[model samples]
Target chain A: MTNSEIMTIHQALFIVMALAVLGSAIFVVTTSNLFRAALMLILTFFGIAGLFVLLDIGLFAVAQVLIYIGAISILIIFAVMLTRGMQGMVPRNSQAVAAAVTAGIIFAVLLLLFGPFRVTVDVARWPVFSLFAGNASPRDVGGIAWTPPNQPIPAMPETYIADFGRSLVDGNQYLLPFLLIAFLVDVVLAGAIFIARQRRPAEIIEDRRRQAEEAAEEAEAMRQAGMTPDVAPLPEGAVASTAEH
Target chain B: MDLINDLLKIIGDFIAGIINSIFGFSPFLADLVTMGLAAVMLCTFAALSFMGLTYVERKVVARIQDRVGPNQAGPFGLLQPIADGIKMFTKEDTTPATADRWVYNLAPLVIAVFALTTYAVLPFAPGVVGTNLNVGVFYIIAMGSGSIVAIIMAGWGSNNKYALLGAFRTVAQLVGYEVPMLLNVLPVVMITGSLSLVDIINQQTTLNGNPGIPFIVFFPFSALVFLISGIAETGRSPFDLLEAESEIVAGFHVEYSGMKFALFFLGEYVNALAVAFVFSTLFLGGYAGPVLPPYIWLMLKAAVVFFIFMWLRGTLPRVRVDQMHNLNWKFFVPVSIVHLVVVMALMKLFVTSPALAQANGGVLVTPGAQAAILFVASLLILIGSLAVVARRARILRLQEAAVLEQRRAENIAAVSA
Candidate 1:
């Protein structure tokens, strides 16, 4: 009968979903195995979808599942497999400085653009505050009211997709951006096709001969060690464990 | 007599009331309890259907091959699934020594659970669906794609090259086929103006004393694409098993046996069954019939679709791997896009014209009008595609013939020398 009980349940669901999202995201980065990392990334997407459902935005929730989980995660796994043996380049990167700088830039941009920046400590808030204020004084931050708004949420239209789609193609609305994105996608696709176009027979033969020469050089290197192994290099424990399963 | 038609809803409501009264729970909690009960019921229904489908698939394939199947298991081979179940339960589940243990254990469960979960949004009787989510069809697509990850996990966990290879090929096939399959759903959504299964179904329902026609009649090209892509998605018939036993030895689940193997098998049949159910809902006018109950109508239509899958499996030789991708990407995808564009364009044109919109008395152009325009467009597209394919095939054959002729002449000249 009490509204408090319903609110508590809603809060509980949010907590559970948030934890799942955070835990899986952390696991995605921390896991050494590429496949497991990819799987965890899917879990993160699923949790984010649950959060979307909690927000009562069923379209976003379904779109999250349809695009992020169904498509993007699979693409990630595909890319991971293409990496040397799906063996995630061992966790410790040699280019730590470059990686850190890139990650830091992405983090800063995201902080300036999105997130619960409200949750940030005051010391970590000024750069975001200034950037959001268009380089005005930090104290003059236009969008930074750290407190959540007390206003009631606006009601979403029932046919949100219909209205949104109409606006997307409307000339005064998102038409230019929409068409630009489409053009960009087309250009990117054409570029990829051009770069990966099939070679002539002579070029293919030359490429294969080069590959053979490289392989012969590798074989020579192995033989020069004077204790050449009979078999190819495989992941540790692979061959020995094959019989059990 | 009244209660008979609405019996299932009555039983479900009764259970919800009992949960509410006994637990003194809030209305939302009581509703949750009812949903939990419905989920369990749906699982039971799916498991039973899964068992029956195995027998049906075997018998259907056997009949096509001119052989009797599973007669040794029980009278008329009706009890064959039970015997097979017993065998599966009794077999040993061996884990690979160096396998990723948690992932190996999780993949089968993940796949099986995902398959079972898709049944939740499918409308059974009028009010007998589990949840009726607004995004029911997309939810199903999302769930179906989840199996791709599980397949990858199974392959990776097995630590076998063949299993890995199988996983790669299956993922490629499923993902490629999914594009056209998911594309086919768009025109239905566009036509119905809703993504929910109920809305889609009601769109095909008789309106204003006018007869209703299934979307398949309107967009047979899309239906053909959906059917082919859906069958490929299920890994059945001519598109069965990228991990052919002769090639990769049972694929992603090659390392699985006993109950683990059973779970994979369950996922397979359940996936096929789910696709059949969705096909009926989308194209066969799900649960819409006069005489029998709506649920019965749905089940019958789904069974017919399921039979068609088995018939294809039994009759058609498995497609060459290259041929399968070529059919999906090069043909089905492009055709589905054309079909979708035609339907959307026709609907927009018809709906906006004041003359066509008013002719239906109450709404935009009637389903009949829409069907006529779309069907003709579909036929034209189908004919044009076939002509292109025929010409391409002819050119390929001529090239082969010319090459063969030159080879034969060279052989004769060498013999004379």
Candidate 2:
């Protein structure tokens, strides 16, 4: 195939993938069945992962599959199953109009900001983009041969993963953000555990409080009786409260 | 044997050469063809492995229980899996009356596809990887995780209460185990300073006169943690609460039948195989062995690990749901965290101290030194943690005894009255 032909193929594939993503995303929100909606969301995630692969960001693609499709989607499905009345007709609300208006405004703003740019201009500026167009040598665009500005570029490592690791940990790059993310993740984990733990029910708390009050009253009555307190019989409530304590 | 070590690479190159010759003028077509071929090959390998594993597991488990297994089929049950496949293909498929039709139909396919896709990053031999992904290990974990969604789908779409309960357990158990599993993996990545499985294997090779040392020797505790968590991740026996037969009736797949059920079975075995492959790749020195083909060595290691899994299934009883959670949260998670800290600290010490580095020939500490340090540290931590747990158990027992005694005394007083 010629350069233009290859570009056409790629463009076609990209369009199909984009359609799949958008279609699934729309289905996710529109689907009445909660379970089906979760499944649609998973399809959306898979489409996004495919896009990541096309972008040559393989790590993010896999992470997307692992986290979004694997963990989060499962949790969503689990929640859907656990909740009763999921299959019931959803109540119609006026908030849908408001949500649609807000979404439309956001979409319009984004389009005005970025949609008008020409692909030709991007290709001209980054010329590396033309490699995807199949008009340029991939070595210059995809290979680890690009030089950094202001410094003699060193030989590239065997894989970019090492560079990615360094960029995260190196003091001059993303080190602070990386540390912040680690801390934030720990906080989130602790918060999740705190939130998910089984809490004492209000009824149980009320019952315990009533039992304690009854026990205190019984103890006071026994003292008031004052007829050899050591030998005096304790009430059932007092015995239960004492056992609990 | 040496030729066998390069066999996959040789075959790959030969095929590439042919494709290049045919589509010499079009790199795009050439690349496309190559990728398609690789995908087909990977899928075939996964499918074949799944079939072989089923037979192997049945025969092995049967032997463990001192019974003849599948001998009526061709050649010691070699043909049994084929028969089972035929039966599954011809069986009447059913969808539950109340099932969400689309999700119910798609769940098994999703699982099988995801399970096969995980092989894309696994390196079978030197220069014989599907893709030399930079984030290879992470990608594997990620792909493995995708199956959890499928499990949930299977459970929910079945519209069965038992299936839903199984799905809940799947999420709770599998997701819970991932933390410690990833934690255990971190130390290996720390030592190698790379996430690529190939790089990790290369670091352990006996190339350039350096000793080839498996990480298992240096970080046995971490390896144990990884293995245990891995078994749980695969939802295999003893940790197979997701499909506990007596309690939940095959768990999420109870409502499935025919080829859909077969797909789930295939996915499960493939996942088990994937876990074994990863365990061998990360900690068993991958394809590195003396005087044997690299791929063969890798297969041997994986087989041994799979056998161990089967052995464990036969030997250990399934733990209760509460006990499984306690094992993950109270024991594995804390120990994994502590192990990560110790590894990081030792790594820092090795990097900063020139004397220590020099003593180990300018790499991280020699494998022997590393083994000694990690072993001693893990031993101390294990003993200390065990002591604490023992003390807590004793205290709880004593408290129960006291409560019983008080209740008995109260009962005697009431009787006297």
TM (chain A) per model: 0.64, 0.59
In terms of lDDT, the poorest run of 10 residues in model 1 chain A is A236-245
Estimate, for each residue in B57-111, the C-alpha lDDT of model 2 and write its tens digit.
Answer: 8888888999887888898879999999999999999998888687789899999
Clashing pairs in 1: none
List runs of model 2 lying over 4 Å from the truth: A1-10, A84-96, A117-187, A198-207, A210-245, B22-25, B352-367, B390-417
lDDT of each: 0.81, 0.81
Give the clashing pairs for model 2: none
Displacement of the residue A176 alpha carbon in candidate 2, Å: 4.9
lDDT of 1 by residue, A1-245 (tens): 46667667878999999999989876766656666778898999999999988887877888898788777988887787776564323223245466567777988766655554443334355555555544434444223455556764566767777777898899999999999999999999899877766566576556556655676677778899885757564433453233222
DockQ of 2: 0.40
Interface RMSD of each: 2.9, 2.9
Model 1 lDDT per residue over B64-131, tens place: 99999878877888999999999999998799887889888999999898899899889887887887
What value of lDDT does candidate 2 attain over all alpha carbons? 0.81
Clash totals for all models, in order?
0, 0
| Interface DockQ of each model | 0.33, 0.40
Per-residue lDDT value at B182 in model 1: 89
Q: Which of the CAPRI classes, incorrect, acceptable, medium or high, describes model 1?
A: acceptable
Q: Of the candidates shown, which would achieve the greatest TM-score relative to the real structure?
A: 1
